[model samples]
Target: MVPFSLTAAHGSIHASTKQVGCQPLASKGLNHTEQQAGEFRSSRRLVLLLGIASASSLQRPASATPYKEAENIQYGLSNGNIRPCPGGYNPNCVSTASLNDLYSPVWRSSLTSIATSAQVLDSAVMQSSDKAQIVIKRSMPNAEYLEYEVPGLFGRDFMEFLIKADKGAGGAGEENSEGAIVLYRSIAGNVKYLYPFQTAISDFGAQRKRLEAIRQTLGWRKLGCDLKECFE
Candidate 1:
């Protein structure tokens, strides 16, 4: 039996690697006619070359680096449980098909921890409102993004309230004086920063430490912390 590599699309049956990269060929060989025989062989060679190229492209490189968030990666099924990445105050939590829950209760808890930690760190070092902005990014099969623009967005303000209401502590500090309006606003705009922003968030040393600890506890592949504080 051939091992099947599956790739999925929106609400569609998983496509096998063959279907993605190979074409079916007639079993019959070149016929009796000499003139037709040459043409048949040429056609077969062309088809074979195309198929090879396609297959090569589809093959996952053995040396390819692993996706950083494989543990947090959620598989979306057309008919399976989906606890989607929750949004702010009005979270749209659903366990229906066409969705897969990426953010779980535990994941939300982690977000809360990071948020509190972020706020604490900010208080210690923050000197400008510009450095206080909190950014959030969500990834899925397609590009579906939701962002919240809050003033004086320090710490985990974006993740905590969105995932677990008011679990994150916040102070008006200097942001409140400038605004008479409720600071939170669902900025209805295209999410262009999903990938890079996620990278930025992941680069934070504290997050990397938490991820390393979680991975180690799970007995998955472990990572080393170069920073003295993180290792301790």
Candidate 2:
């Protein structure tokens, strides 16, 4: 290759015309002032790099809400969910049933069919080389329930989705609309924590984010589980 430029033995930069770079300060010794100036510029670049790295490290992280101790977590259709979506004794779970914004925002089904909803869920959970696996699925008269083993950074969560096909007229929140709603609840099934060293490694608000990921997969908007699905 042709030389873009060459340095003179006397002392000068060897670089492309577009930019000036490289110092032969060591190869050909320079005056004390010139050497100090070069050192100062190098030090400035180093400091700038370190400052950027420090800022990134200090940025606020996603707050994780942890359930330190194991609590009474209930599941299944027969196990008394008299009032579904209620906050349980444990903090590791997030539900469409809770009033807290941290847990209330529901994924809109957007007139998607119950069967299609199931398929979407199946697809979402099945995409990442089997990252999310359905462990159990059952269907009743108007609803379908599916349980999934969703893996997280620290552990896996046992997530359940109760997808209900509402007629919207006969007490489905409206007198003449029709749509579907999915009630989600997840518990830290096997959260790994190193005791006192890492006592809390439960739900770091991952439940909603997981659902949100599925929402994007299904192309659904955010809504309250109580609100009727109106978009076609």
Candidate 3:
């Protein structure tokens, strides 16, 4: 039962502490065209980094035993029924089951169906996990659940989603017009942000906050846009 930690792309998995950092490219002597090219390259590199964000941080022997489903943190399952963090658990996890304002509301997808929702979730999954570490634990026509080791304090999390055939917000199957209602949730194994004290930096309600970011990111992708353009 060894704990895992992500140290950005620098340290190994299960490192003492996990982290992620960004290093901006030096732009001192570049002319306008070169600087713009550099910025585009940076954005593309960031997209790749995010797709396999946890891979570079893992360090394990070839002989290490494989992880079993029984060892998974059962925050319910990856299906539509995932519940809130366990009683007395740390503040690191969030879910749609939570009525608390700290949790992000479920996301509505631009398209819905076994095919389309799967397309988006599939892309999200690759963006979130290392190929070697992710495991598809459950699957159904309208639902999917996966578990993987991330570079972090606990190094494991579950991502689940269910696609409703109905158009979003009580509308039916407007998968093209309004899309379907998609329920998505992710929960981490780090319940104790701090050993015994919950402070402002403990990442409390973080999962709650990422929803908007995810929405914005998806919008950008659909429009074939990148973050640099927004900033400029």
lDDT of 1: 0.29
Q: Which stretches of candidate 1 lie over 4 Å from their true place?
A: 1-32, 59-232
The segments of candidate 3 whose C-alpha lies over 4 angstroms from its true place after superposition are: 1-73, 78-80, 128-133, 146-149, 167-177, 193-201, 204-206, 209-212, 220-232
Using TM-score, give the best candidate's number.
2
* True-structure RMSD, every candidate: 19.6, 18.2, 27.8
Tens digits of per-residue lDDT for model 2, 133-164: 88888876566788888786556677777776
C-alpha displacement of 10 in model 2, angstroms? 99
Pick the winner on lDDT between candidates 2 and 3: 2
lDDT of 1 by residue, 92-146 (tens): 2221111233222222122223334233323322232243344443433211122
- Compose the digit string of candidate 3's lDDT tens values, residues 1-232: 1123222532432132222112233435556686678567656665565456555545765542212222344654533565655324444566656666435455545564546665675666566435425555456544545444444435544554554554333433234444545455665554433334433124544454444354555542222233454312
Worst 10 residues of 3 by lDDT: 13-22
Task: Summing lDDT over every window of 10 consecutive residues in candidate 1, give the lowest-scoring window.
Answer: 179-188
Ordering by TM-score: 2, 3, 1
User: Highest lDDT, which number?
Assistant: 2
